[model samples]
Structures are given as C-alpha cells and as structure tokens.
Target: MPTTLRRSLLAVLATAFLGAAPSMAMAGVNPPTVDDNLDPGSSIHVTKTVSTPVIPPRPDVVLVVDSTGSMGPAIANVQSQLSTIVSSVKAAQADAQFAVADYKDVSDGASVFTVRSDLTGDPAAAQAAINAISAGGGGDGPEAQLNALWQIGAGGNRISFRPGSSRVVVWFGDASGHDPSLGHTLADAVTSLQGVSAKVVAINVAGGDGLNATGQATAVTSATGGQFFPSVAAGNLSQAILEGLTNLPVTVTAETACDPGLSVSFSLSLPRTVQSGSDLVLEETISVAPDARQGSTLTCTTRFKLNGADAGDEFVQRVAIGVNDVTPPTVACGPGVNPSGRTPGGWQQAGFFQMVADDNLAGVSVAIRDDATGTSFGPYAPGTYFKLTQAPGRSGSTAVPFTGAVDWHFGFRGDATLVATDAAGNTASATCSVPPAQK
Candidate 1:
C-alpha cells in the first residue's frame, strides 16, 4: 500500500485498539456476587451513607438595571423570575451577597437609586428588593449609562467584598446611553470601577435603534473584563443574567522550584499561563505548591522537538526566571572598534565598535575592544549611534571601511552579571568575532 494509506490504516487500528482496551480490561475482572437469599424481619437494615462536601461562600454581585420606560417588560420579567434567580444564586453560593441599583432619566439629573445594600447570605431580602424594583420614566433623553456604570464600577456606591470573592456587576440597558457621537467614551466608567475588580456584564434591550448599543455594551464589558449579552428581550433577560453571574472565575498562582546550581531542574505552577509563543504555549499556571521554592532562581531549559527529533540545532531561545524581591543579573558585551593605521597628513582615522547585553532585573551593558594588541578601546553604550565613520581611508590605503564594514581583529564578549547577589549566583557568558570583514 501507499505510505499515506498505510499510515491512515495504522492510525485507525491504533484508535480502535485504544477504544476497546478499557472494555476488555473491565471484562477480564469479575464482579462480586450478591447473596440471593436474605432474612426477613430478623435482619437489620444497612443504610448507605453519603457525605456532602462543604460548599464555599459565593461571590458578590451587583445588578444595575435601566428603569427607563422601555425597560418595563424587562423589569417585570426580572421581578417575575426573582424567586428562581435567588434560588439559583443560593444554590451556587451558600453565602452570596447581592445589591441592586436602578437608573432613571439618566441624562438630565439621572437618578441612581440603590434599593438594597449588600444582602450577605440573605437570599430572601435580595429577592424582595428585586420584586420591588419598578421601571418608569427616563424614555426621551439618553440613558445616563456612563454615569450609572461608573457609579457601580468605581463610583463611591460600589460594593465591597473580601479578597478571593468574585465581584460581578450586571448592567441592563437599551440604545447607546452614553454619547458615542461626541466621543463620550466608556473609558471613564471603566477606569472608575478599578478597585472592586468587578466584572461588568451589559444586557442591551433597546429595539430598532441604529445606535449600536450592543457594540457599546461589548466595549464596556471588555473594558472591565466582563461578558456582554446583546439584544436580549425581557423573557430571556433573567436567564442571561444568571448565566453570566454563575460562571466562576479561574484563579491561578505561579511558583518555581528546581535543583540548586548548573543543570538546575525547576517546575512552575502559575494560577494561569504566563507566556505564549509560536513554538510552545503554557497550558496552565505551573503549580509547584509544596515542592517549589518561592523567591528563588528557576532556570528552565526546554528542548524543542520536531517529529520526535531534537531540533535544537535549528534555533535556540532563552527564558529567564526571577523572584519578586531580588534583582536579576544583566548581560554585557565588549565593543567592536577598528584600530588606527597610518593615514596621510591632513587625514584622520575613525573606528567603530558595538556591544550588546540584556538583563531581567538590573538592565544591560555593552563594551567594545580591539583584539590585535590587548588594549582597551571603548566601552560605549550599544545603540544606533554606534556606526562606522563616514571618512574614507586615505584615498586607497585599505579605505577606512564604510558603515558597519570595518576590520581590525575584533572580539565581542558578554557576561550575565548583576549587582545583587543570588543564592546560586547563576550567570552566563558568550564570545564571537565579526566574521573577518568580508575579504
């Protein structure tokens, strides 16, 4: 058979074997037989007991509703679903807290009324307040969505909660309330709600308006790192709100621990992936919990493979690891300056050198030098300014090389060194020449 056909058949056979392996294993093991005959009233009844895991407290939630006349249907629907909403919240978080805010006539003296304070672990009160909210007024002018959003997000009326508690803010509106025409941005509103780190969800209910309320809602949601539910009607409003609130935020923490010195081995557990690149991506936060050390140097040496073969010969990249408090080492290189030869009278010789270095904590430093006679030439900082001199070499005596094409037995040296001393004092060094200035 052809190579492609053979490979496909092998893959199919492997998949089939894998799919059947579990059933085959189970069939090989016989289950325990049960006794058919049992005593009647004389035998005691054995009950099967199950233990329930303790449920943690739920996150804090703030509901921002638009009470404009257009929201009557939505408000009524939300109130009707109050019981189910409260029950779902309670089921998910035994100690969840909830707050409600309503915005009316938002443009002119936009009214923001807080119907309830944070009702912690009190689902009954939250439901009562939800039932009490009435949608009225505020239909002619624009909805003061920016002001309402700002108040809930960063405004003084924002809800407060303990660390690790999820903070959620749901905004219900229709039509772009803020003035998108005059660049009345949501940035101010987004900036205001920074402290609580609240996730803002905007549910736009405006119908037949070309104002792009959905787009505006999405912008506000993305700004606060929240989700957007657009053009949802009153009937589906409660369900959408619950869906957005029920999602638990994924928390991640990263740590690194490894063997002490050269050839060090370390593992990291971050609450989430720290970096992503073309070759490899972090699947999840590396968790080194008990095994990994904190505030220590972790040297990671990953091997790249292509088709199960080492591809390190193709390309190699370095990844640096450092802790919060300590300052990491820096890399520095020597300059590449050309040496001076005899120039005819009234002629001057100019040489150029370049160096490169980098550091995670302390920064970088570079120095240039001439290798011919062990003498120090220059330690100029490496940058675009380090270019070859425009002057020609005395009309023919090896014409002082133009631009970057200068020759004079040069060596580029660099070292990874820092001011702060680390536990392992890990460092790196490299050296290379300018490849003999092209003939």
Candidate 2:
C-alpha cells in the first residue's frame, strides 16, 4: 500500500469512529453534574489535503551507446530511430537536446571513449552522429563504462551538457563495466554526476548465453538517483526516456486557518513534493488549543503546487483534528423575599452544564450584577458595585451555588442581572427587577 493511501485511511477512520461510537464523547462532561442531559461546548475542527501532479521538464539527453562487439544490434536500432526520438521529445520541450557518447573496452586503443557529438537541439545532427558510431574492439566480459561516464560528466557543460537544464544520461549496454580499473572509478563517476546534478538511467541488454552481466550500471544509476532496466530492448527505450523526463513533483506551499488556537509544523526531512519514481512520505503535526473541547474536530487545509507547473495547476489537503471542550454552567433568577421600598435583592438558581443543564451538578458559579457591574457571563454591562455571596440551595442537588446578598437591595423600579458561567467559558444570564413602590 502507498504511504499516502495509508495516511488517508487513518484520517478517514478517525472521523468514522467519532461519528459511530459514544466512546469519543466530549471529555470532562460528567453526567451527574447537570439538570438534564446537556452538551459540552462548541469546538473547532482542522483538516488538510494533499495533491500530486505530473509536470514534464525540458530534457538534456546524453545517449551513451555501448559501442562494443556484442552491442551492434541495439546500437543499430537506436541509430536508426534516433531522429524519431528527438522529434518526440521536441514536441514537449522545444529546447530539448540530444547528445552522443560511445563507450568501448580499455583495450580498444584511443577509440575506447568518444563523444561523437556534444549536446545539440538539432535532430539531424544527433542522427548523423549516431549513424557514425560503429560497434567493435572490446575484450573481456567488462568494459570501461564508468570511465565513459566520468569523462562525459567531468567535462565542461559547453561540450557535454546544457547549463540550467535537467540532466539525463541514458547508458545502453550489453555487459558490465571493469569496475574502477579504467581511467576513473565508480565513485569518481558518482561525484561528477552529483556535481552536475545528473541522473544515469542504465538499460542492460548484455546478460545473454554466457555473458555474466555485472550490475555496475545498475549501481551507478541507483547512486545517482536514476533507474535500471535489466533487459529493456532498444525499441522501447525512447518511451522510457520520455517518461522519465516528463515525470513531475508537487509540494505544499502554504497553510492557513481561521482559529488562532491551532499550530502546524511540516516535515523537516522530506521534500514537500514527491519525486518521480521515488517513495516520499509527507509529514506534519498540528497542536490543539489548551482548552479545546473533547471529541471536537479541528480542521486545517494545505495547498500544493508543482515545481514550475502550468498556471492554476495546484492541489489541496484537508486535515481534521478532534478534541474536547470545557463547558460553562446555566443560571436563572427569581423574586426576592426582602420588604419593598427600602431595597430588594433577588434569588437566582444556578446549575452546572456537565451532562444535562438542571439535573446534574458539581460546581456552578453565579454572579449577581447591578446595571453597572457587568458580568463575564454577559447578562449585564459594567457600571456598579458588586460582591459574591452563596445562595440557599439543596446541597448535592442539581443546583450548585448562586451569588447574591440579602442586603443588596434594588430600589423601587430597580433592576439587576443574574450572570451564570461554567468552566468552559459558557455563559447564561437572567434579569431580576423590582416593581415600582405603589406607583
């Protein structure tokens, strides 16, 4: 299974389970503390989504032909259709170029290594150079393959490659290389290739009857983040090369959310985008608010775009996080027993909204507010003096405590506000008024 698919599954499962089971109920919502089966509070959800796209790149191809005694058939096939390959690539990238390099054995004299033609955008020139190469003069099972790569890679870009272009070296061969015994070692080739940011895709067609096809080509390809085809024929080589050149990578560019309580961090090791033919894991971490309600989902989104892709070519990921909320209590007001005229204070009942508002209870806060002393529960605005006092209530009943003073009087036609607040910042308010004195 792909890593992306697995991550997606986990995210879906989390949402699925939350909707199905009561085990994921809001945290800290104790049922015994409220009047009726009540709910916690509202919470936020964050979701993220990822996107992938394929964008082709301008190609710089160095067709490394294995010009040895055993590679005549493949070389001829390549040389014959060389112009067609250039024509195909030019359709995608007008600036695409084709270069030529032929490799022989160390014993093949000065003809052992030759760059018949450097990089050129002209199809006719590339075909002529391929036609000029003739296969022969190779001894032993292994040839100077690494030496050929080292020479071409170490050479200046003017003669070998184009600067500011994607580098590719397609090495077609029948047998393995003579390790590092030639002019340069495999390590030297790797260094040169890395320095030029080039990849060598090796196609080995030599492991026939008696030839012990060594894996030097495959190793070098892997080292340079390229690919190896064990027995790819010459006819299919053009398609393979084209596919590798055009493959693309997309990456996360930005993320934003409405809630100020969430924080996100991207992976440090993995590149934001997936590389062609490579398995990459996109990682990120999102932290929830300290007072986030349990079982609440926090959603976040991420936007992605391909490297130099076409305009409006982008993708997105929606990520969801669940949490719990801290809920507040509920309160109500009633008439006071104080004598009329002088002053009158009201009695207010308060209950914690743990499970159900009125029935369940543990601790509930009640605020007695005048027109001036504005309460946080938002029943009254600030303007007057205030004090906290416990109200009469059935101990261990649904109601917890209420704030008020018997001496806190309201003049005739006077009014006060009863404010109720719970742990999770939830609030409720009630108005208590005194009738005019025999108006």
Candidate 3:
C-alpha cells in the first residue's frame, strides 16, 4: 500500500474507534501538527499561512548634516529646501516627523557634534534649526559625523524616535568620517544603527575623496539595511533626503528553523517587498526525507521579519510531522482440514490445520476465528506465537493413540478466518475450511 493510502485507512480506523479524530488545535499556526504516516521513498506537502499586522506609514526622520566650511553649499541647500522636503514626505507618510543634527571636526570643541533639533512634527522648528547651521572651522580632513551617527542611533532617546515608526537617518556629508570618532569605532557605529533599527540613507556630497571615496558611506548604509547615493551634487541634498524618506523599500523575509529529517520551502521567493498596511500571505511546503526512519517526528518553526526587524507575534508559524508505515503482512492457511487426532479426554476430529505467515516489514502476528463455533483466538505475537503447539502425548493404556496439541486444535470447525498483522497494524487474511470429517 502507498503511504498516503495507509494514512487514509488509519484516519478511517481512528474515526471508527475513537468517535471522532481530534482537530489541529493550535494558536498562531493553523493545523499545528502534521500527523501523517509517510513510508520510505514517499513525500507530502503542507501549506502555512500567516496574517501580517497592518502597519501604517509613520516615519521618524533625522537629518545629520556635515557642518564644516567645505559643506556650505549642502547646508544652504537644506535651508532652502527644508519645507519642500517635509511637504513631500508628509504627502506619503502623513505622520512624518523630522529632526536636525550637525557635526564638525574634533578641534571645534563644543561644536564637534550638536543636536540642532529633536524629532518634531512642526516644520518651522526643523526649518529654523537647518537655517541656523553656520558652516566653518575644522582642524582635520575627516569630521565627527561617525560620532554623531553613534549618538543618534545609540544615544538613549536623544532623537526621540516615535514608537512603531520607521526610523531613518538622512546623512549628507562632503568628507569621510574618522575611523574612531570619540572612542567609537566604525563597527560600533554600525551596531548602534542596527540596535535602534535605524536605516541610514547616506548622501555623498561632492566628487572628491568624500564619504563614498573611502567606502565609509557604503559600509554604513549596507550594514543598516539602508541606501547610499554617491557623488551627489551639494545642491541636490534636499532631493536625496526626500527620496531617502519616501522611496525606501520595505522587504519581507521569513527565518525558518527546521529539524534534521524535514525540509521546508516557500511559494513566494524571499526578501520580497510588502507594502505598508497590506497583508502578507506565505505558503510553505514541508517534506520528509525518503530515508527517514518510520514513526520519527519532524518539526519546523518560522518567524517573519519586515525590513530586517521582527514582525512580532502575528507572523510566526510552527509545524510538526510524523512518518508512518503502509505495507500489510501476508498469510497462507490449509485449503482442507488436518487429520483427526485423539486427546486425553476424547477423539478431536477437526483439531489442527497447517498455517504460515510473513510480513514485508517484520513483527508478524496471527489471529484465528472459528466461524462455525463463533470462537476467536488470538493475536499470537512473536515469542508466544511459536510456543502455541506443544509435543503430542498419550495415555499409557491407549495403544498407538493419535494425539494432538492444545490451543492449535478446534473441537469442531466449518470455516475459519486466519489473519496476519504487522507491527504497523496493517493486516491481511485468508480462510480455511473443514469439510465434514472423512465420513
């Protein structure tokens, strides 16, 4: 029998025996467990569905600008275009908030890095902060922008990012950042960005040895799952900020962890985009290895993420699988009754019958039922089965007595059913008939 066919049979048997089979009762995952019997070299597919929570477009944007003499043009651009940029972002994400921060060289003392404005919904305050930035003085080629990123990303609510809002840092600079700024390494800065779930859209101003020229911009953006715009003109700083806020892509991915004998696959390719406030459907196929041991259990757990961050409780699924056997045992019995035999009490006419049984998988047992007498005998399993028939014995007084074994013989039999069963409960049967004793 095929694995699937056997599973069907088991289901029918379960319903017949237990009133009703239990439902797949589980929370968060539909059909919590995959309880099926799968034979070797066979497979089954499963589907998993998860309802993505609705996430409205709420953006918490922070503008980190280079405040060095060389960045005069970029600062001027932000002052001139702040209102337009805010309007554009608001058009897409109505709940967008903005903040402003600036950084100069270490020698600039208190001006090395400054939070010009905390995150706010008021465009005027954001605009005022940008307009007040005076670009000047620096003692080194590299600036303290790296330090600024670390502070904003890991500075303990320094920028005050709103809850459940998309965190973005629009960083525009004309110089590469110092490797170790204020005792924090580049890696430390990147970790900070990830810690706060902040994406840095780095806009490299001017073509010369700037942020991109040293690969700092690329590293920061890539590490934070953000974007990097290279060789952007200082005048287009505002455009970069607008695009960074409005055009950023949101990707959906599932992190699946499964047991050894089982493997899982999805209907849709991973790392795909899922729009905000939209539902995401994931169809997964679960399969067991052909060589897996029968009756072994398989399992898998998957958690969905949105843009490199966990999508929370509503987006999790778990699966459990079971392997089963399908093939039934085979049995053969005598076509006619055996010779009559005498016991200590009397002559047993229809006593013994020849029988043999075998199973493809092992652990074969037998059951015999005398239809005429309505008497049933057992499920004679392995060790006990072979011990059913004992040596024939006779009474001393009776000469040449025809002795027969106990249990194996029947007092009277017309037709009997012989059933052979295997360890998996699969069975096969044959009938043996006893015609009226020799007449």
Q: Pick the lDDT winner.
A: 3
Q: What is the lDDT of residue 182 in candidate 1?
A: 24
Which regions of candidate 2 fall more than 4 Å away from where they truly are? 1-56, 92-94, 155-164, 207-212, 234-236, 239-269, 272-439
What ranges in model 1 sit over 4 Å off? 1-57, 107-110, 113-115, 139-141, 180-185, 206-214, 247-249, 254-269, 273-439
- Error (Å) of candidate 1 at residue 425 is 36
lDDT of 3 by residue, 1-439 (tens): 2345334433432332224322311113344455565566666666654433222245788999888888888889789878767765564445678999998988899998888999999989999999889999767788887788888987434788776677889998888878788877788889888888888899889844688766889999988777888878987676666555533556667788988877778777687775333334556667777776665677777776656555455456667777665667778663222233222221222324445677766688887765555556777653221111211231111112123332244332335677888888998987765344464
What are the TM-scores, per candidate, against the unseen true structure? 0.45, 0.48, 0.50
Better of 1 and 3 by TM-score: 3
Candidate 1 lDDT by residue in tens digits, 308-369: 22222222222333333233344433344333432223221222333444444343344333
Write one digit per residue (lDDT tens) for candidate 2, span 26-139. Answer: 111011111111123333222223333222244678888888887777787777656656665564456778889898998988988888898888888899899999989888
Candidate No. with top TM-score: 3
Model 3 spans with C-alpha error above 4 angstroms: 1-56, 155-157, 253-266, 269-439
lDDT against the true structure, per candidate, is 0.45, 0.53, 0.66
